[model samples]
Target chain A: MNPLWDREILMLLGGVVGLLALGTTVGLVLDRRVTSDAGRAVVVNLKARVRSWWVMTAAFAAALATGGVGSVILFGLLSFIALREFITLTPTRRADHRTLFWAFFVFVPIQYILVYREWYGLFAIFIPVYAFLFVPVRSALAGDTEDFLARTAKIQWGLMIAVYCVSHAPALLMLQIPGYDGEGAKLLLYLVIVVQLSDVLQYVFGKTLGRRRILPKVSPNKTWEGTLGGIGTATLIGALLWWATPFSPWAAAAIALLINLAGFAGGVCLSAIKRDLGVKDFGTLIEGHGGVLDRIDSLCFAAPLFFHVVRYFYT
Target chain B: MSLETLAAGALTALTRLVTGVRARWPDEAPSTSPRVYFANHSSHLDTLVIWASLPATLRARTRPVAASDYWDRPGLRRWLALRVLRALPVDRSDGCGKREALRRLIEALDQGDSLILFPEGTRGDGAAIGELRSGLYHVARERPEAALVPVFLENLSRILPKGEFLPVPLIGRVTFGAPIRLGTDETRQAFLQRARAALIDLRNR
Candidate 1:
């Protein structure tokens, strides 16, 4: 058997499958009960969301099954698509063409390559330190100073969110825990499950019991009831899965709460970018999920935080 | 499949992966009937993107109207133009050559093959639409039965601009608008302006 599919990994996969089956049943029941036109529209969207979740979960599982290199490639491709969607909306002048090319083709691949090779020293500072200075220099060489600082800043910011942050999820596989050898996949899975579960549960709770809005201007759907309920439930679930991780039950719950808060911040920040661009979604790639960026925005925030926290305490 | 067909498939797939082409038809679904797809020209990839955006059935019968001076080179370019794209190369050096090119386009339309035409005659900076040449008007007058569809290709020039050899990976949107035809008793200038306006209107849609 591949080391990636140890006993603990199998149990995690089985749990995800069981949850998906339950979601399918709820979607079917809701599809039959909704009668009004508005209610039917919401039900149809909910069903689409559930259907896409199954496909995404299968793809993720297949990637993890192939080992660390497979996961690195998958996240690398997602980062590419997400960065494309991000820059497409944020307008840049002709002078920034070559600079944008370096960001997409050069820096992105180098960053992921470092992660795959487990070069901890360079992978941590490659984007933030080197690419940060290289972007403006390349744009300055183009000799068009129309919006020099703004354009360079936009490209660098996009690289940080789309490539740098997202790569940390697969980078988790490079962690060297004392006893829990070759089981970083489980920890990555735990972070993803808790973060994504919080998102889905927030939507469910908001629709059912949400009365007050959290941020009326930024995201109208986020409610206090949804946030507290979803994060509270996901933290408890994470604590129960502490046996798979190199953490105690209380430590697991504390880390889950922190991850949930960071994920929430990620969603709101990306949402503000959308509102600034005056568009509803980033791109129409996914059926119910807006784009690759929209689907993985929460992961963008949670992954880096989770990676550092685990590296500090456990490793 | 033939070698040419295999090469075309590979080229289409590469174009889609690099550009992430998102094609939308705001007016109606794409039809298989004979039509002229006239779009704004800004980069070399404009023709390929438009050709790749077509449905496979329509792509089989659609030929692009390309400039012979550029694509008529000796080796690989000529092979791609003649075999894979099946482009009808037009000479733009002289008046006699111009008439000959129009004759060939009319012949292709009569044979029930659609043509992808760039009426600007040359590449632009992609900021604004250039003045459309008279070839689109003449083609419309000759083949009145074929529909004239306006296609707007956004962000293609940014992908592979005029002088850049390397293509930046970006999303390109192809929007097809409602078809128009030359009006009865309309002069050449009036009909050309109307056709240009139709193509411009699709930019926002």
Candidate 2:
């Protein structure tokens, strides 16, 4: 069999199978204890998640069938919608409008095109180097002299939110983890699955045993009990999935904890952004879920950190 | 559905629940022709307050001419304005005279519709009323038969500033001034400044 298929594949499949088993068993047992309000919320969230799961699962299956280019295109669409939501909330001035147009129209497309072509070197520098210079020139052409620094910073931020942070998902195809020959796609799947799992677990744990509010002002939903419990559970699952990844079981567990922690921080920080923008949720892009930003805000934070860690060791 | 009274009722309800709603109107009788109710710009909520403050019968005959570019965007804004509110549109970027858009307004007025105008042109920090743009004067001159009602929108700037997207829940008042008739030889600039003064006068009162 393929070297990448040795144990990590089994680990992932096994871990998911095991978690589903545990989740269903525990969910049924705990049904009696949950309050009506909390139970109702869980049902609604679970249903939405189930819907998203089927959709993502279908995409995952499609990625496996179609290979890198197809998967990259899927992620590019996600980034576009997420970026649109980000810019919609953060106000841009008339001066930066042209810069924003390029960011949206030109830079994002070019970045994804680089991924499609698998030009890793150019893909890496496209946003940071080329788009960086181009945006400023566009802003300068507007000739509106007020708030120059703020205006420039806003354009930079728009790029960061819309393009750079989102580009990490597609960047996964560039990875060459030894022992995982064709498993880069699986790694991407693992990353998304783990990060989203951590998020969902935290919410579930927090609602159940959570007492003291962690940060009521920013996101009233977070709680210390939930954080500790969710991280613990996710780490355990991560360790179990070590069979599917290039890492050892312990290393997998450790990475899971890091991703979980980072994902939580991402959610909280984005919540603060929403609060600043005076919106309850980002744009109403998703039906039950708030927006594209709301869905991937955690991914934006977790992706870079996860990529760096995997690259540092596994490579 | 009288847009203003409906708006006023909603504004009143929202203010009562959060901060509180207050209003003022022109002391004189309603004009037969179209009048531009010009006031200070402050919050997104400013338009709602002015629209809601009109009398029911008069509200039916009035339209708040909003920017076509902004309100025309898909989503909640378009839904509320086009479907529920029925606001008119004026193109801010058009180089040609606003006569085309104003003609639409004239049609509304000719059909016995009045209108609300933001003389400050756009939203701003409500520290003091900003300089009046000449568009209001043009509109007023075109419909000389329409009485010019100066309205002062108070405390709205603080409640929702220009850069801020969200309204800080706070008490705001909309004050309407007495109707001012345009003179046969009144300079557009003179009439515009005097109309702006009426809004400024209500800030303290």
Say which candidate scores most in lDDT.
1
| Candidate 1 residue lDDT tens string, A278-298 | 988888888888898988888
Residue pairs in collision within model 1 = none
Steric overlap count per candidate: 0, 10
Q: Kindly list the per-residue Cα lDDT of model 2 for residues B53-110, writing each as its tens digit.
A: 6665666566787888889889878867665566887887757746687778777777
**Number of clashing residue pairs, candidate 1:** 0
lDDT of every predicted structure (CA atoms): 0.91, 0.72
Question: Which 10-residue span in candidate 2 chain B carries the lowest summed lDDT?
Answer: B15-24
Q: Give RMSD (Å) of candidate 1 vs. truth.
A: 1.5
**Evaluated with TM-score, which candidate comes out highest?**
1
lDDT of 1 at A158: 98
Fnat, model by model in order, equals: 0.65, 0.00
Cα RMSD for candidates in order: 1.5, 11.8
Candidate 2 Cα misplacement greater than 4 A, ranges = A1-42, B1-205
